[model samples]
Target chain A: MAEVVTNLSRKEQVIRMAAELFKEKGYSAASMRDLAQKLGIEAASLYSHIKSKEEILRTLCFDMAAEFRTSLSEVEKQNVSASEKLRLGIIGHVKVMAKDLTASAVFMNEHRHLSQPWLRDFLLLRINYINRFKTIIEQGVSTGDFKKDIDTKLAVMTLFSSLNWMPGWFNPDSTIEPEKLGQQLADMLINGLKQNA
Target chain B: MAEVVTNLSRKEQVIRMAAELFKEKGYSAASMRDLAQKLGIEAASLYSHIKSKEEILRTLCFDMAAEFRTSLSEVEKQNVSASEKLRLGIIGHVKVMAKDLTASAVFMNEHRHLSQPWLRDFLLLRINYINRFKTIIEQGVSTGDFKKDIDTKLAVMTLFSSLNWMPGWFNPDSTIEPEKLGQQLADMLINGLKQNA
Candidate 1:
């Protein structure tokens, strides 16, 4: 069986290889030398494409934050009811994790280690993404599509936590497909098994 | 408010303080001198209580693994049905995260950095605790108590990914109490809101 050729850019290829190293071995444990070796280039050659390991992390975090924001935007554009929007929101969150697990992991785990001004900006983006979800949930509750008792804010946090951590466990090589995983997660979030009247 | 007195041993005290440093700053970034400085002791004097920073990490990992295992054992001892056992199992998992968030963080995040022997022991204990939940889930499904359509192993893993990650989001100061959080998560996992049967 022939392997599928993945057409990655020089920059994109570095990000992919760095993400694997960072995830398998935590950021500090994985070094520039190791990453350079994985890329089949000299350590000095890596600098031509990337400034530092920190930049690689920031790239991953920023790109994921962008993609996540984009997914939410797409969900917002759909002319659907609040409940369907919420379902789509869940789908969007899981799909991001599924499609870009490494970037998602870097965004979720390593962004906390970023320094001051950059960290603040990264956090602002993350909080905005979170609020986007919270607003959708709030709309669902107000529109009578979800239970009145639902704490829209806390529910969003719990839902995001559940969805964000999926990359740590999900294996793309496994039999479970991403869309199916999204649907199962969305079902659990929206209409948990208790029969709705 | 009166200051709460700590009843931890000198060694335990050292480990506790070190864990906070390790958690806030990644393990590689935290130093023995920094740990000793935090404890109000000379760096050389600290070796009397511990061999090195790695030793502190090993002790913390063992403490966390033990706490988790003990909680699972209590769940196992409960004279309840397999489904109820599963609920308690999840509750137990979340409780550990809430109560021992730092140690749990170190165990979950840093154990891979351990030397081979310690890593082997940590993995063994980790698997043992995981198997407890898997067995409970398997029993529940086989008894027709849980939705048999759900893969027991994946469901157990997903449940764990959800619970184990609570520390990243949970705040003790938050209005949501652990008990209520546990109950809500339990409901979401077990019953999922699929219109109440």
Candidate 2:
């Protein structure tokens, strides 16, 4: 039983290693053999854990999706205002990226590598996730908290685009704390870049 | 001489085809042979126009960089206020991305594929371009146009993060004109998202 549990964790280790490889070498270019090599195991041995390169890509993308949806669900349950929800959403999203940079990068950039059925489903999940933000912005507008004239679609795009791109340049070693960075982003998005009009 | 001119145009065509391929297949995964096949030419014939795959990537990235810097310079020359400059900057940036979606995607996503001195130079150019926005935001803060308490670095990150990610989701066929979309984004970024706050 202990050996079985260790094997299961080793399987997870394979996925984690694949995520880093995918992040560094990109999904299409990084072969399963390369992943196996990275793990100091024979190429055939990798099969015991993961099915194929596509499986790894699918796992990374969906796992990250699950992470975001989980966070969004938590935020949705809060009895906070739309503005506060937006703030928490940003923090949740950014923290996920900050904590798992490799998974986030792969999730954002390699979703297209997923094959059909999975690709279609993943894209749907992505759109639904984005719509969550859109719905929040709509709620804010309806409540007179957000500008009614603002394009809600464009606002959501701006917010998600900014949040999604964070993993690309965000450095864990940087002086800026991830939580603080999230707050600043929330402030800018919620308060606008302008001061006193 | 006519043949020579034709050859020159074919070289340009090779670069253009490579841009499309890089956008579709990604930089590292795309082979020169794939580009040649896409162009309906022999792989060896491709050598007459481009030296290597990296050369094509270099051309695309630097070319896009040049396009942006040119636009940024024009925006910089304007005697408008910092806020106006920022609005125009957003418009210019979005327009460029909209006009050349393939090249913009390559530039934004494939720059990491560039190697050596070229990579170093390209990153420097990118930083300088980002600093232009940082300077404008700083000027806004100094002039009390933007929130004084805002972190300038974070502000620049949020702005460029939003702008650079535009190519990923922007659909030229969409109802929103690129200029109008830019205006909406500028309005959101320049004015707070909250209404009547």
TM-score of each: 0.88, 0.91
Per-residue accuracy of model 1 over B51-160 as CA lDDT, tens digit each: 78798889888888888888889989998988788778777777877887888888777787789898998999888888888888777777777666666665666677
- Model 2: TM-score, first chain: 0.93
Give the DockQ of candidate 2. Answer: 0.51
Best by DockQ: 2
Q: Write the per-residue lDDT of candidate 2 for residues B1-197, one digit (tens) a residue.
A: 99999987988889988999998878877887898899998889988777888888898899899999999899999998888899999999988888898899999898987889998999999999999889998888787777667777777888888898888778878988889888888888877522333
Considering the two chains of model 2, state its CAPRI-style docking category: medium
lDDT of 2 by residue, A1-197 (tens): 99999998998899999999998878877888899899998999998887887888888899899999999999999999888898999989988888899899999998887889999999999999999988988888888777667777778889988888788778879988788888988877887622332
For residues A1-197, write the lDDT of model 1, one tens digit per residue: 12223323777899899999888787877889999999888988888878888888888888888888898999999999887888888877788788888878877877877788889999899888889878877777777777777656557766776787787778879888788888877766666422253
Off by over 4 Å in 1: A1-8, A193-197, B1-8, B174-177, B193-197
